[model samples]
Target: MLTNINFSARQALSGVISFSTCTIMVLLALAFSTSAYATAVKQAPYEPDVAAYRTALFLANMTPVPWSQINDAWADPISNTTDSISGFYALAKRPGGSALVEQIKQALAGKDTQALYAVTTRVMATALLEELSRAHNGLEDGSAKAALLRATALYRAFEDGIRFLDRDGYRSTGLAWLDVNSAAGSSGVLGAGTLETDPEKFGAALSIISDYIATNYAPETFTARLEFNAAPENIAASGASIHLAFTLPPGGTIDDQDPFPMLVLNFEEGHGIDEADLPLVAYGDMLFDSPVIFGEVAQNLGVSCSTCHNRSDINRNFFIPGVSHQPGAADVDGGFFNPLFNDHRSDSLDTPSLRGIRLTGPYGRDGRFGSLRFFTRNVIVNEFGGAEPTPFMLDAILAYMREFDFLPNSKITTDGNLTDEASDAARRGEILFNTEYKNMNGQSCATCHDPSANFLDRRAHDIGTEPPAYKGALAQAFDTPTLLSTASSGPYFHDGSQPTLGAVVNWFDTRFSLGLSKDQLADLTEYVETVGGADEPYQAFDDVDTKFRLAFDELTTFATTLNILIPMKDAKHALIMINTVAPDLAADASTMKNLDAKPDVYRLAGLLNSVASHIKKDDWDAAQKSWNEFKTLQDAVAEGMF
Candidate 1:
């Protein structure tokens, strides 16, 4: 069964009550204010002509009112009615009025506090009468009808000379900034005879507005056509082929009006090629269940794949490193150089877009995995906890990743080659990267990092400097990050300490890594700069690359693209511990009692708080003290409680 969930303003208001009483009070005050609340009504500089307003109002008001009277009043704006009740009834019969009536009815039935508050403060008394007159004939609840009528009159009497706030305020405020423009040269405001005189233009304007609301405001709706069990059979029958379907937004069509294309980006592992299958890793437990640890790991150590690759669209930009770690907390390992030690800091761990990995270089951030096979194995062992994947699964996942092809950018290309002189410089830089130039030290870029293939030396070396102390294991030296997609992947360096490629080049040039003169360094940076986008060749999966397939899938999923990156063993261990230990802790007061038994609860709390304080201040010593204290407490609990 398919169920549609609709979220309304009333629901939003209700949910906020637990966390925000001030906002709730303000809304309540706005609803009850007698004066034309300045904030409640929003009006455009231009007003709709009387006729258009009347027509729109009529349609919005669901109540039945005399059409002839509305038409007559609209036709002669000069005619004034002193009787407020009569004027309200006349306006309440319109479409907008009907919508208000429905809104009130729904609110009352649901006991929506916000809606009731809005109606009491904003709805005109006469409008309430019109609704009551219609509802009286349809309902038998006398008390409810009377209550509604009384509430309406009470509001009307207090109205004074203030104008009723316009109902469109909410919509206008919510949608003011969307980049929607009128193509038909018609202003958004409806005026007298506009709809009849230029129906097409009016329709187009409405269509655009509707589309904007549908795309941005409406909740996403999805329907499950096939169950999870259907996947394995489908893949087995398809052999090497992969199938994909995109669920489009409602009211959206694949046409010129909508230029965006739907694509299923694919990433495959090396071993999968031999077996003609796709690889799948389960990353849900890491992402949702243990986000804290997963987040910590992603922030400090540089991940593979996404280290150099990136997506063209800003929204779909670089994968894990670009999105995930960019905004995370500071580097955990204090900027150490060792490959095994944590050293980076980032915000969110974003998944990289494998849109152009085929065109890019020797893979991985360190370029240690010269061949895709070696890259695949390293990822599984080091990052994914040494899980072996089935050959078919690896093949399918790899094939899917290869689907990401880059669209050419007009700004950079001329006659198929990069037009920017810097790009040509980058080509020269590539040569200097692999070979030593005159006036430069014997050390080439490839001396420390591989440039012909993976762009890494597959070996660690001391970069001759150490960073500040921090939590987590420390590395003796830092590993070199690749420059494959140096142009797009900013905030360069192993710890992402440098903000730009130029800054990185300058640092290494002056440092002990590769001392080079100004001209040599410039040429080197130029050559490496052109290595971005999906211009590189794709690596196919082969029999010999069996081990590489799993590694490739893990790296791709972990860094450049979305697949799965879970270590099943770690997940299983965590789950087992939680189920077994948490219950036992809950059952006996021994765990909680142990704190009182030895160190005492007060002391233990102080120790834990001290650790938390150090963590807050970014003090490694204080943090270590707290960790050690907590470990002792854990041991005490194990002996006494367990």
Candidate 2:
């Protein structure tokens, strides 16, 4: 049961959100604003049975609003809400559901948080599973059983919705969710995914809901997801701490947002603290969670890096006005289609997974930039009209992004190691990959991609992956992305033209005329999806200033790639970090730590700051004035400076 939340979105937002100035660090505090990507709509499946089952499934999975939104959600003003509350009651009335609805009603009516939590988590989930068991045995609608089983998953999702695990999907405090395998004692999706098949234990554990919920909800006992964060610094060193000023309590306050005053938590790595460079990582975490960093358009709609890239979800359901091709896809370059923004040509690209990004390079579908720093600044400036990143902020983000790893998979023999115990099918697929069948225009998959290069040749190729109407550069050629963790970032290709690895095989077969049989295609798909992410971190840069240069250059490249004014506020910070590390080098990559050059270096930074400030106000004359002075100083300090 795939759960999708559907709600109406404000339609008139795109026109208003196109341009405005905001810097990444400037808006770090606006982390928990309204969600911009709330399900704007639910499209029909065009089949009654499927739609009914889906509806039942979605209701079962809905979770509580963030604690801050509770009052607006449940207060008496519009208290007749029938969504989750009504859905639970309806499910309780289903066959074999028992009197769980009454228990739930009492819990809600009494405002009994403890009773409500238990009843909602245990009884309702249990009752639904029992009904689902009956459905599976053909005593009831099997579809309803199928739908009811999804309830546990929804309950699980509900818990997740409450926690909203932000620090790379794991938290040092609060409830840790259990995987619970399946009812048959198999590690699978919610309801153990086997309540019907293994009735003896599976059905019983669910039947008593309390039996299983007790183990799952035990406050102090649980497996910590994503390994623990780095420990705090030594006791003598200022007693490591971080400002948890933006935090919402585990379950949120009763009536309103807590406005967490002086809420400080230990500087634990998993709690927005990085043991390696605690301050840098904390700053990055705040920036990542901040929605105010984006232009007015994204802010008004409540979008931010975390909005799309958070622990709970990557927001595959996100949609924006005139920018969404479908639920999971966004047209990043609105200027290409909308004259009001910065009229250009249409260039819709797929969102890449941020995890394991260090291994997955040249950025974007075209492989736009070569590294994370480059890609990071480019996204800020172009996608959000953000102020340039300072050097420190860039490094801070660098530390944070380094924390992301590939989704765990066992197929790859070792982390980032392409070598695997090649199964017979994979071997055959490798043969097909290297073989230049005459029918394929003498093209071989291995010619440009193979395991030796992480299945990416670090180059672009044309396999004609374009629709008849697409005239963009990506339609003909696209950068070869890693097959590492290919399972998650799908519908494949620059435009998300293929939904699965098999679709890629099919496209090669039809377009390149490979004429491969079904068996061959299946073998190829097996190899691609089975690959895993690197087990250890991939460190790309050493000097913070040198990294700043690469990142700044990447942002510059984004401007040439397309015509638009991207307000990157990062450079001001970069300028400072550069001076701290290499004073005489301006932002260019030259080794010089001379104290004599500090004044000139800072002067250049001040000029650039003025440029950023002027750009924000749409004072192009003043912006260009300061920009030219900064550029002159940049060149005078060293060559290759921007």
Candidate 3:
């Protein structure tokens, strides 16, 4: 008896413990189910169509709906009819038709005029549909065909009615009717409205509408479109070497050089001078110290501003023309005319342009140069194997370049202030641009390119191996190009390796610099996307290749037409330097030092020396290498990285 009593106590204790454990398990499961249900409820209630309708409204430039009204309609359709229904009707009328119907009904409750009109349109359309259905017969007979025709006519009438309503500014009414019909179904019983007065509910609806508007209508907020055309053949036919010619404004002379009567003929026919064209002449004359002429002679010789810099409009294909130089081919003495060689033996080369150079700094293909003056000097001597200009000539060119300006009032701007959400995102991006928030390398935007001065450093720096082939000291040192008009200079990167600015920035972030956070990067991209284009149309080209050829011709013609009015006493110095010096020698870096003491003679002497060195070295390999290396170094120095 005593043992049994003791066992009962233990059993009771065991039972109590088991009951507690089971109760706890049940509670845990219930809690989990409730949490999951809550999450599903939160995410599942969105109506995609509703969101889209809101977006269409925004894009159509309709005024935003008031929060209070939106909430009232969402909660109780009948009572909120005045505000919500009117707003919905207005939105539907913007683009008109089915898009805004559902929203309109929810606000109007069939009582609004707009809603009634919409219902009438729907009823008429349905009647036409019913007629069509009756006309269709399984039997392929005359009656069936006749019925079909009648149905088609009725359908047309219904469509006409819809069009008439839209034109008469009753689009909101039609849309509201359609919405009511859809919700009521065949029974046509209007559902009673449920009033939801909570602010949280209203906020949710606003969020949904905002998200939809952002996704669908965001593109309409800004305006900047690009249009391109090929070069024209007739332009090339003119005596002008380069098919394309930029015009200058009246009274604008190509600096210092008295306006010549033949100047009109120098450019392509029908090409008139304009204010925009002045900068080109001003820049060219300052660099060449003579009015730059574009004519047949220049085109035939393949000489043009584009000869070294290449054309910016076209893909940066090398400007070597249709000819190629064979390894052992007769040396291209600067004086040689129409030299042709094996195409198979040619080497691919990079040919970035000088257009928009003012915006891009640390200039050059390799981004090795910092200063435009330095880069220009080096190219004249080393790359072109040409005579260097006198100090006056150099000064003129520098002055011209300094005057280079982007077309005024060309930047894109948003129509209105961005919503608070968008503004916040953009601000975040601005901060990222100004600070070092990325990971691979810690340099901020300023570390590489300074944003204050058109986002250029006017200097070159090492960007590591942008390409597998680009390695060693030669590729390592590159100039920083300006970012002013970078928005247009697509196929970004020194090698045109990246296709877009976003890619360029991303490459720098992930591969060169520390990678950026997705949000931060998005912000940066948004800012970049706002860059705009000029109002005037870009000059159309006839045949780009022909234009390219003309560029060469114009370049030669310009060179010949330039009258260097140096004193007779200094003529010999000019002649000896221009004629006697080997074109290669004039461009040679090693020989550059010998001519440096005489700055005026440096370009001519350096080019001559570079040419002489190549010829004497008898190794085209060494010659080309020297030329390329010197150019890289020159560009680097100009950009101030060196």
Candidate 4:
């Protein structure tokens, strides 16, 4: 685990602290000239640049660590460090060694602090993935696979959080502590939380997450593990499935801070997913966080599902004009511009919460897509301009999505009723929300936004909010979003025109001519902001980590299988592979520089855009040219551009 300390490395000694880390090669030539050059001993499995970074970290720590002395010592079998960092760093001398070392050196000298942090984060992220690949033999590996995958997810979350906070832009604000919202805080829900000074809060933050993963999930396998069977997700619903809960560790409780917090994903009610098992959920989670999929092409631009919708929720930091209306809302179709994918509608949809989405549907603001599968495919390929996702990849994406859920706010019931613990205003709000009493004109809020059904009637409404000349589907009839998640995902409505609950209520009250006192309106807004409750907690699976590890393996396996089949000659597959591989390769840009591919990245993107035109016109030759250019770009990746 790499630490993100603002302080320089600890002074074990001033002696070794200033020794040049770049002296390994020169020292090796002089000290070991007479002795035979010892064969490179890889301490562990690694990709080329990973090996180089690992070595750089090791040598950077040890003052005056001469490669020649290490080489001479390693010549003796008794001096073997075959399973250690020093041994593994030695692999940098192999075919791709020098190049990766050079890349690391640049990062070491680079002026961009955010980029440097991203590089170390990438190393830890890849390291867990490598371990998972080795440990996951098959489905039968069970706990072994789940443990590894969970570790991978934690590492991914660590990497993602660091990228989220820093890569965009972070600075040492002149404050000891800055007021902030918790990750769980959304809209107006859970709004009060605190963070220390930026350096104190951020420094080594990645290491903290990484270490938790190491301590809990570092083991390759479990000895004896618990398993569970699916039960009725709810006694009220017949077909829905329950989350396979786990037995808690000795007094251990799931916390809100857990990135992949143990959510009781009762996805059985939805027919969208085939299995609601832990492993499947974990597999799905990994794919969503991975830039190797939809977020690939935008890797250099810092776009990932995690980059935008962090932890499957809203990204509070993203703010590109047209692409992002504010912090959390974004225009999905703004990712790329091309004829085939663009409808030229220019619709700006509010970013919906993927959490608890298994039950909330009539997908999208237009409620156009009948199934999540179609919605997912369209978002990646058509909206984000990701390469065409294969059917398997789509399924994996949906699997991850089905498990999303909102945390228990505990302030209100599922029906938007105030709990005994609710504030006086919230209680008054609950009364107004559930009341069928109409104004003199016979119009009632509950008639349209039904309380029993998560405050939505499963139909679109004008509500005086529609733009008469809007250019998208059902142009005037936008879907009614759930009031339950209103606290976490707003600026409201299709266009995110309203910034707060009070604003939304004000618009509705005026449109409906509901004459209300200021006190009444405040109470009503409070309930709407605080509504929505949690389902039953999971209490079954004792080995969630193992199950998750298995899922991670399955996800990786699927990606590998699908990606390897990409032939640059096939325009379609080539496009998909480009989206998948480019971002994936770019993920390590922190320490690994793809000098040759860097320029081609943009060229390939332009070529990809031109390809749609050729394909649409059935111009085989033009398409061929585009594909060939793509191939040239890909070749840089194959040759280890980083």
Candidate 5:
């Protein structure tokens, strides 16, 4: 059975939380304090469904509450349709859920944040009571068990708040839930041996939970409010550490970002690439992860190139409140991140993946820059307001990024034709995709997205996508995006509006009046999914800790480049290497499991700091001495640490 966890906030929050009293207090303090983005709205609603709750919480926890976006989120359930919640039954089926929807609509109409929050929590409390009553009254064991499970999901909405407000109540309530699940028992699979429900046991367990909710969460009793803080804090900052206190623009979250923090490098051999063989690549890897290359706020916040382009691919979860219209998209030139780069327009574009970047550019969404180096330099200096990158820095970063390869796909061959592995529907769709139509001005899908050239013509077109800010404004054209691996990369298009391949096909059909039949549309969708699909689109690291170790090892390997630089007496690039490695070592060491070995890790970092000091003074001998010491210490502890 599906739980209300799994890639959700609860799961993402698990690793970061220490469970200590001080930890809880600190987190709560951050939560309640006026966030950099949050406005006058003191609290967000306690929503029942996890998805709805996340969307609601995201909107409420903005600088000036995005009332428009919040209304759009609510607009889904306000209509007469019911949707699935964690593969359970429809949303309205939950106790008092329908009434809550209506209340949410009314609150949205009235523009009352407090009333919205109150109604949401009150309904959740009442719904829990109703479910408990249904479970007790139900004759069937299976039906009773279902009710208990639904009630458990509802209870989770208040768990964090309850943990904050009342510890004893939290403990008791948690135990009650476990007991109730045990009492309801399980129906064995394949109708083999079923454990019948115990009415006496069930009543005892149910009462503990029911009484707590009635006393604490009843409409009149419930007074607490929920406020979420998603801003990325400088976790690396410690007293005397290289990092400084920094804050995010808005809607920055480290929660979901933590799972896949490790930089994934692909090579011809796949995985194992010696840093010694590719010194520039190694240095570039460190530069990509290092925030020192960026300006003040970005450096302090630890925002680097890797933050948006995780593993040389799109960081789809990257979001900012005012700057982003949706997740996986941000207005890089917006006033929020850097006022100097603001284009004075709210034109938020989807963050395109950098995989196969060397092949895909003429860079930028509009294909504005012909040179990749120029584009990258502009990103550093113009977009994020970082200082002009040094020649070596640019060269190394370019070398690292050029190594990024597209995910391998078996369904499509070199020329982008569907292989034997592709479905018949996909093959049929390919014909339609290649066929030119008069409706599109004698053009076809293949006109822009040429199958022979990685599904792109290396050109930009208006395609009716750009919404002009003014009546006389010219429509902006976007570069033809490659279709490879787009199956996993969505919402599609420049603005991330189309959510699926089918949606994209439907959009084109309507926009150009193609008069494609429903079957033809389905075939076209299948073709795109086939071409875009990959066997393994993402890194296959087992867990977050494993990825953390990999990242630590990579940083250490990258640091070895200092060996060559120190001997050559190259102070500039050597200092860049030192600065990047030192802060990274300090930050990564905190997450290392071998706590006893951490001191040695810090000592190694201190050596880098020493080398940096010598480099600043241009004392090559002293820098080499510190380097030798660092290498000796690293050789001894590198195998055991992290």
Candidate 6:
């Protein structure tokens, strides 16, 4: 796939370690002399400057790159640095930093997408070398240890590519990184248990990594192939429709800070309910929010069913640059999430609301699926590349989904008609809705929509919403979407081509030759809006801290399923339950306002993970014992956490 450029031309070798005989001999001698000085310890935390710079650099490479947010993340004030990128450039103190930065800036200024991506990624790979060199220069300094950590994080940018392109190289480079960490040693906190640095081991390990980078990602050898396995960078924008299931709107920073996004659930009722009262539904809710259900990229990014459908409603702000053509829409079978499911098409569809899902049958925009179970399974396995759900999991999800009632409406009656509170225009439009048209048949809008049946006829219609995919292809018959909460879920039609109810009415009026006047069109739009209206279209938010506390409690409710799973000896589901709840507990705890309660929350997560380990060992008694401890700890911290 790659044509070789010169192997040794224009190679930047200043920071690289040459494997000359004398150099190798010197390194080996130092390593042996200082071997006794090296000691093992737990890994240290990454510097925020390096972390922020890494995020910003990756963001800058994504398709339809979010330049503004990348800039903000780079210059995040909380980093206590004017710009993380600049700070890192200074820290590395290596030549060509200014030139690389300028190249990225120039490419961005020119709006040259490919050039910017290439240059930005080159900077990411090269920065790893500079940090490693900086670490080697000062092994005993605390900052040197941090430099080593930064170098490890930076290598991940190209880790995948290296594995794919050269497997043996991957193993060597990976092991060398561990060696470097061991060689660097630990300074320890408060002058306790400090391990002195081993210069010999550090130099030898440093050479392996430096040579690997030089041969693959140096100035002369660097190519796009080296970045093939890089992590996905197309994160949803701050105001994008894609949101956290239980989080507040316009979710928080990636770091999880105060006033950050918090969970905001919306069931049929205007208030929250106790999940313990409906155990199966509660388990289903947990499954909906658990990203581990999906494969690779989705799981890595923490995406789940609730990402697109926030609180059972469509997430209007959800978007991924390459996968989504617009906010609130995504090509489920696109190459972004899973190439196995790519249909070789750009058919991004509008995400439908899950509210009143029980009444809406013949799932999918094309109405190709007859059973909800089959459709749900297809979405998991084929669409998002998730594992096939167990029957119990499926049943639980169905039970939870069936409980999704439409938002309450006051002006509309049970028969799907407006009451006396309706405007005169709506009443007039209601007549038109039921009136027979004679374009080619004596059918009316109500014939297909069926107002009394929650505004759906449970049928597909070839009304020419769009052309067939190819010549000789069958007419595209789209499922009739329910109008129950249509007013709140805009951008109508299968492809989201219509932006409003009025636009939809206008399209139909023109398409079917409805020969209606302007006033008549307005009336028809009004009628449809009335049928779709709800008292409150979305859930109102509580303060961030309160939302986090509610989420903490809800997570525990999700864990209650462990009681049934363990008793049934269903280790599979039990382990799934534990894995799902544990990570959230740790992460959510980190963002809690009550710093004092953080430790207990972390302990709760650790205990749950311990339970999973016990289940893996087939120790039911141990698992149960751990679960009980987890519950006890939860109760203790319940009153103290945010």
Top lDDT prediction, candidate number: 5
Regarding TM-score, does 1 or 3 come out ahead? Answer: 3
lDDT of 1 by residue, 345-416 (tens): 322222232344444435543344456544544443344322343353344334444444443333234222
**Per-residue lDDT tens digits of candidate 6, residues 1-642?**
122312211111210232334324433332222100001121233343344444554444333345665554434432333334443344244456666656656655665444544555666657778888888887755567878866876675555445433446778887988888877787679999787778999889998998877555544422322122232222111111111111101111112112222232344254566667777888888888776677644664566787776666676666654456667888897644554566656678988887778888888898888899898888888887778899988988887777777777787987886888989999999999999999727899999989899898999989999898799999899999888877877889987889999999999889989888999999999999998887777545466536557568768898988888788888888877776777777767755678898888788888988889989999999999999998788777676566
Cα-based lDDT for every prediction: 0.34, 0.44, 0.35, 0.44, 0.68, 0.66
For candidate 5, what is the lDDT?
Answer: 0.68
Number of backbone collisions per candidate, in order?
72, 22, 80, 23, 3, 14
For residues 1-642, could you state the per-residue lDDT of candidate 4 as single tens digits?
A: 234311222221221333332223322232222111011122323332333333333222222222332232222121112233432354344335444444444555563333333343343444554444333332233343344344443233233222222222112111210211121112343655432233233223333443433432232321221111111112102221111111111111111111222333445333444342443354455456544454322432324465555555554444433234345555565323212343434454656656667666778886777788888877777666567777756776687787666666677666656678778887788777656545524646667677677677777766557766846655477677777655655667777788888998887678766777899999989877767433322223234333323332332333332222223234444344334433332222222233454554445445655654575576767766765676665555444432
What's the candidate order when arranged by decreasing TM-score? 6, 5, 4, 2, 3, 1
TM-score for each predicted model, relative to the true structure = 0.29, 0.42, 0.34, 0.43, 0.63, 0.65
Tens digits of per-residue lDDT for model 3, 157-258:
222222321222124334433332232222224645532233333233323322322222222222111100011112112221211111111111111111
lDDT tens per residue, model 5, 250-286: 2344222434422335653476767656888888887
Across 1-642, the per-residue lDDT of candidate 2 in tens digits comes to 112211111112322342112212222323222322221122212222112222222222112212212222222121112232334434445554446555545655665333334444455345434544543354232353354445443344223322322232223212212222243333347756444434454444443443333334322322321111111111102222211112121111111111111111234323565333354554555456444455544553445575555431244544432354444556665531112234233455666656655655777777767887888886667677556776766786776566665554455653233355556776666677778878766767766766666667778766666554555433566787667655655667767778788888888888777778889899877666556322322224444444345333322222221112224334433333222222112332222244465566557646655655665576766766776676566568645332
lDDT of 2 at 290: 43
lDDT of 5 at 588: 61
Better of 2 and 6 by lDDT: 6
lDDT of 2 at 214: 36
Q: Order candidates by lDDT, high to low.
A: 5, 6, 4, 2, 3, 1
Model 1 has an lDDT value of: 0.34
What's model 3's TM-score?
0.34
Number of the top TM-score candidate: 6
Candidate 2 off by > 4 Å:
1-32, 35-277, 310-314, 335-341, 371-374, 414-423, 439-441, 467-475, 532-642
Off by over 4 Å in 3: 1-301, 307-350, 353-371, 390-392, 407-428, 467-475, 512-522, 531-537, 540-642
